[model samples]
Structure formats: structure tokens, C-alpha cells
Target: MKKVKRRAMSVLAIILCLMIGVSVFTYRFFSQGSQWVNFTANKHIYSNGVLIGGAIYDRDGNPLVHTVDGVRKYSDNESVRCATMHIVGDKKSNIATSLQKVYADELMGYNTINGTYSVSGTGNSVYTTLDADICAAAYEQLKGKKGTICIYNYKTGEVICLVSTPTYDPENPPVISADDDNYDGVYINRALSSRFTPGSVYKLVTAAAAIDNIDDIFEQTFTCHKTEVINGQKIICSGTHYEENFEKSLNNSCNIAFGNISRQLGWNTTAEYAQKLGITTAHELSGIPVVKGSIATSGGDNELSWTGIGQNTDLVNPFAMMRVVGIIANHGMCVEPYLVEKVTNSSGFRTQLPPNKTEKRYLSQSTADTLSDMMRSNVRNKYGESNYPAGMEFCAKTGTAELDGSQVSHSWFVGFSRNEKYPYAFVSFVQNGGSGAKVAGVAVTRVMTAVKEKVDSQSTAN
Candidate 1:
């Protein structure tokens, strides 16, 4: 009797173990089934790691990439292929955030139930919110310089133009060596992966902080003598602006006055406002991660002053800065930027991605209005309206970030259009490019002019 009872207990234990193992397998199969099916090792949708099917098109239905008889092909125009190489991706998966790599499962038509088998002779189609012509225009403005230019519709969160330079032709990729100066950072997308010293463009954040924290900030007066001593450190300015109010200080890009303002705001307040302004926040666009900007709050009074002026240990991502300007343009609220516009499955079922509806209010309406007026004054009085297209109503700020070891300062131009018809925000950054108003600012004007022309033409056609 004892032997028989032990046998029954052993049988029960074995049954329980098998049941638990099956449950765990079932759970993973339901949760991560798509990842397994979309793996590059799969032979159905991918041919030696390259997607065998599916097509990628721009907003205007311009084909950017398509699979031709089991072979991948890019745009016929070499310039367009190079301009959008970073976004469309290459065969070897060098660009991680490219549509080919990030949205592979969608392109392969892998659903939870049907898997890759649901895919017909061809894979699904991906339609992006990018404008091929605008991207090509931006690429031309880069002029072989290493930099990035991104422009997006602030109201709809549609990224119209995103161009990163040092890109090669996707149809014929070059062998990039580590010591190749021209090909440095060729694999990385500068707009999404890199951070820059924001320069005086960061003053926008300091200005926003002042408007909210300082009660009588607009009424205050400051003096600039081309240089001022704060916390025993010398803060230099481009020119001497004898005496000026808060608005004039910004218009002149007075470092001494801003350094003094920073001293008053202190490190704690400055860091708090930087976080609130989305400078220190990481955002994801259409499943691609954007690196966040950084600021250091733990420092002496001198460091605090420099930080306030966007100098000390301050690094900003161009995309983040563009979003900040977009938020300001949208009156303190903004839709998160996205690239993928829609997807059409092989079964003829189309899915249109809705704009991000999460109402993120980073600033109060009053502060945004005040800043808008100040930025407009910046374009009209400081940056010169002639620098932009006529009647653009362009509001802008330019920054020249000084680097160490005699490297030329990085040029930065960030701003938004107040024109209701073309509600867009843009960021232009040029590495080792001197004069933000000249180099980076010119890039912005050229690209925005192209954008304005397109908008007007579309309106006429409609």
C-alpha cells in the first residue's frame, strides 16, 4: 500500500510540472510572438537580413524604397537617396531607427494570429510623413558640412523634413573607416542621436524661466559693457549695449546681462525650469528614441551663471529644441512629433495613425504669448526680417556655441512660424560653422522658403 501511494504522488508532481511549463510557453507565445516571427533570421520576409517585400513612400506618394523582385532598391535620384538614407535605412541595418529596421514587423505583415503567413506575395506598405523635396533642399543647404536640419508641423506633429549629413548613397554605400574625417558619425543620425552646445539659443529657456519666476522681470533694467564680472568670473558679450531693458538684452544676446540674471535665478531655479521646458527629457518619435539634452545644476556661482547663458556643461539635442519651439508656437501645448503616417497591410486593410492627443502643456498661455512677442521682436529687430522670406512672420533665436581647443563655435538657429497657414517649427545646427545668423540661419531660411512655397502651391491646388 505504501509503494502504491508514492507512485500516485510522483505522477501528480510530473503532471503539475508539465502544466506550468505549457502555461509559461503559452504566455510568451502570445506576448512576444511577433518578435520571433519578425526576426531577421526568418526566411519568408527577409532575404539574408534584407527585407524582401514592402514599399516605403513619402507623404506625396513618392516612392523612397521598394523591393524589386526580391531585391531592395532606393530612389533613382542619388541626392534623394542620400538625403533620406538615414530615415529609410540600409540593407545591413546600420541605421537602427530607420523604417526598415524599426518597423520590420509591420512591413512584414506579422500579426499575433496570422504571423508572417498572412503576408501575400508582397509585404505591407509604410507611408511616412516626410517630404522628399524638402529633405533634399535641406541636404543641399548642408553643403557637405556635418550637421542636421529638422522641420516639423507643430500643430499636427508631422515631421516634414529631417536631414542628417555625411550620409552616403543607399544604393552604393562607401566603406567607412574610423579615421575617415569626412565620414565621421556617418552611421549616426545627428538630429536624433547627437547633442550640441545649444549656445545662445538656450537663452530662450532662461527667458521663459524669468517670465514665470520673476514678478517684475520685464520692467527690470540691465547694463552691458561688452563684459561683466559675475561671481568673480568674466562674462563676455559680442558688443557693448550701454543700458537696456530685458527685451533688448535678449535681442542683443547680451551675455553679461544674462549671466547676471542667471546669478539671481540660481542653480535650483534654472535646473527646475530646464526640466520643465523639456530640455532634460527624452522623447520617442514613431518608436525611435531621441536622446535627451543635459544640464548641470551642481556648481559654483560662476558655473551657475554660465549655465544660465547656455554655456557651462549644457548640451541640447536639435530635435528637442525644435519641439520646445513648437510648444511655444502652439501656445504652450503641442502634439508629440511622429514620422510614420499610415500602414497598409497586405490584406488591403489600411491603418492611419492619429496624431498624439496627449495634451502636454509645458508653459502657461501667458508665458507663451509673452515669449512669442519677444521672439517676433528678435526676428524683426535683431535677426532682420530680410533674412527670411517676406511675410513669413518668422520668430527666431540664433546661437553661437564656443568650443574648446580653438574649434570654431557651432551655429544654431531655432524658431517657429507664426503664420497660421504654415504652422511649423525648425532647428538648424552646423558643426564648426561660425556665426549662427549667417551659417545656420541661412540654412533655416532656405529650407523654410521651400516649405512656404510648397504650402502655397498646395493651397492653390486645393
Candidate 2:
């Protein structure tokens, strides 16, 4: 009986030992397999390359956004912030944050401890046609004085340079407050958000609209003076423009003459033109957030007149206006504007992104040509003798928009470069500046001169 009991106890001990061994083996096998799977997954992700930040480069491989001198020299992993602190924006907020959602898969490989990933070396680098030195020189010349400066590649809609002051740094942008007092700080993207009366700039639109719709627009001569009564309200021209035809009317910035043309075009046509050019409510800007801007909907004869004259509830960004000018320069086709060239990964592997599609034709090629000619003539006749380049041929338009009930007004200038063989388009605006031609033109000239010099240097170098 004693032997039987001991044998039974031994058998029970053996069974318990077998159970513990099986459990240990099972645990080891699954744990090892899980670790292996995780390793394989991560390896695949990094195999393609380490993800990093995006960049903008000129045709010559010159960095435009600029880099900090001492930080991570080559590897995007440790480089300091670049100049585009305001332009390219940050990954946390503003335009870059929203862009991240769209580029999630690409940005996934470079997750950092801070929960933010570097987007620099994920794919192709953005290649801009803008000359960096030219952009720098232009910005330097127009640093002070409230104004906007924008340069665009007419063919590709690639914005070479777009600066609006007082400019804010995107890296450390002022916190936008809910209070109205914070409006100034919120003016970070004045080139795209701030609404203003276009003043004389609308004359270009009026001229085009009237010519397209009215047969006798060019034939009619209208006298413009202190004021003209429209719907019993007094609408005034800047100066005593006197009696002039359409061509002279534009050159003089005749408000009365343009107001009449606006009445003829009607509010609907004016709105249509605005929509075609992606202005007011129809325009879409990635930085401005994926939404359309506000355009006044109260349509009236007087409102139409105001709209035609670039006033009465009409507001647009400088970028949008520049695009309108680009359409004419590009023979009516308005291409989509893009700042990024291509994104690359950390391993230096490149991926070509599909080009942004060119959309919408606002005006016919013929209209574009005529408008271009008219703008050129107006510039030559007014500032030509003093400001005109001897060998450069260009078309330009200036605007002095007013702020109702206030002496302060917004000044604007838009034009295209017709250099020897290169074509570039730009827009400039000065907030609360008295004269568009003087305040805005001075800045525009500096930029254009720098651009020309850069082009010349590049040509010589090549």
C-alpha cells in the first residue's frame, strides 16, 4: 500500500511538470514570432528610406527657403529651421498641419519622440523657377511700408516669390485670438485673406467685360470728374479725368468711366469674371484653408457699378489677382499655383509627384492679348519715361483702393515681365499707402530689377 501511494504521487508530479514546460514553450514561440513580425514590418518601412521634410529649390539647385548654417548640415534629420518659417509653415499648425493628413503614409516613417515627424526627405524636392537672390533682393528693397509682392511663373503657375508685409514668421506665428484686436496678427496671409476695394485695378476687368459684351465700348468717350450720380448716390473718380475714351480712361484710372462700364457689364457679368479668375467666393487656397473666400451676394445696379469699379463689397487676395494677370500672360489658360517640387525620403530616394493640373480659361487668347497691349501702353504712357526699362517690354496696372470713411487706402500694382525672352508675372500692394504707382511701383521695380539681374547672371554663367 505504501509503494502504491508513492508511485501515484510521482505520476502526479510528472504530469504537473509536463504542463509547466508546455506553457513555457508556447509563450516563447509566440513572443519570438511577434517580435520577428514587428521587426519585419518596420524594416520594410525604413527600407524605402527615412522620411523627412520637404524643400523648395531653384533650377540651379539653390535652396530658396534657406537653411540654418550650423545645425544638421546634410541629413534632414537634424537640420535647423529654414527661412520659409512663414512661407512653408510648420507641421503642427497652419497650412502644414492640414497637409500632413494628406501626406500621412509618406510622413509615417520618421516619427519622432515629440509626436511630430519631419517632412523634408520623404520624396521629391520642390523646384521653383524663382531666383533666390532676386527674391531676396526684392524683399530687402520692400521690407518696410505696407505692401505685397508676388512673382509667378506664368506657364506653370509656380509662385516664384510671394511676400506680404508686415509678414509674420510661420515657425513662431502670433497666436490668433478670438478678440477683434487680434485682427492685425491674424493678417498673416494678407495676400490671400484681407479684403479691399480694388480701386483702379477693376478698370482692367471693366475694360475686358465691356469690350467682350458691348460693341461700342471702345468707341464711346465719357467725361469723368469729381463725381457721377448712380442711383442718386454720388460715385467719384480720383481726379478730374475729364472726357476720354476707354484706353485713356484706363490710363487715367477714371472711376466714373469704369463705373459706367460696370453698369453695362451688370453685376452678373462682373461676378462671372470674378468667379472665372477664382476671386471672391470661388477662389481656393491651401494656406487659406480648403475653403472659398467671401464674396458679397447682395446684387444691385449700384452694387454692380461698385463691383465693376473694384469696390462695393469686392475683396480678393493678391495671389488671386496675380493669377488673373497670369491668365492674360499665358493667353487665357490659368494654371494651378504650386510651391512644392517633389518630395524625397531620407535614403535620398526620389518620387515624382503628379503635376498640379492647369484649370479654367477666364478669357479668350485674343482678349488676353488686347488687355496685355493696353496695360503695356498705359505703363509706358504714365511711368514709362522715368520708370520704364530701355530694353524690357512689359504690361502693368496700378490700383489705389479706398477704405470707406477713412483716409487710409490700399495701394496695388500688377504686371508681367516681357524681358528679352523670359516671361514672369507679379503683383504688389501697399496697405494704407497713398499712391499705388509710387508706393507699390517702387517695390515692384526693385524686385523686377533683381530678377532681371539674376537672369542675366545665370544666362552669362551658362
lDDT of 1: 0.88
| TM-score of decoy 2 | 0.75
**Each prediction's Cα RMSD?**
1.8, 10.2
In candidate 1 the C-alpha lDDT for residue 142 amounts to: 89
Q: In model 1, what lDDT does residue 74 have?
A: 89
**Per-residue lDDT over 1-462 for candidate 2, one digit per residue giving the tens place of the 0 to 100 score:** 999999999999999999999999777755553333223235432232222334445545665432333111121311112223234434333433223333434333332232223354333344444445554555565555555677877876666775545544433445666774423433354565455667777677667777688888778998977698877788888789878988888888888888788887776777777666666544544323422433454566667677778878777767777877888787777877665555555455554455555667878888888888888878888757458544557788999888878678888888887553557788888778878888887788777877776667778999
Highest TM-score: which candidate? 1
Q: Candidate 1 at 52: error in angstroms?
A: 1.9
Clashing pairs in 1: none
**Span of ten consecutive residues with least summed lDDT in model 1:** 350-359
Tens digit of lDDT per residue, candidate 1, span 38-146?
7788787777788877889999889899877767888888778988999999877889878888888777777777776543567788999999999999999986898
Off by over 4 Å in 1: 1-13, 351-355
Question: Whole-model lDDT, candidate 2?
Answer: 0.63
Displacement of the residue 276 alpha carbon in candidate 1, Å? 1.2
Off by over 4 Å in 2: 1-59, 63-83, 90-130, 168-183, 281-300, 357-360
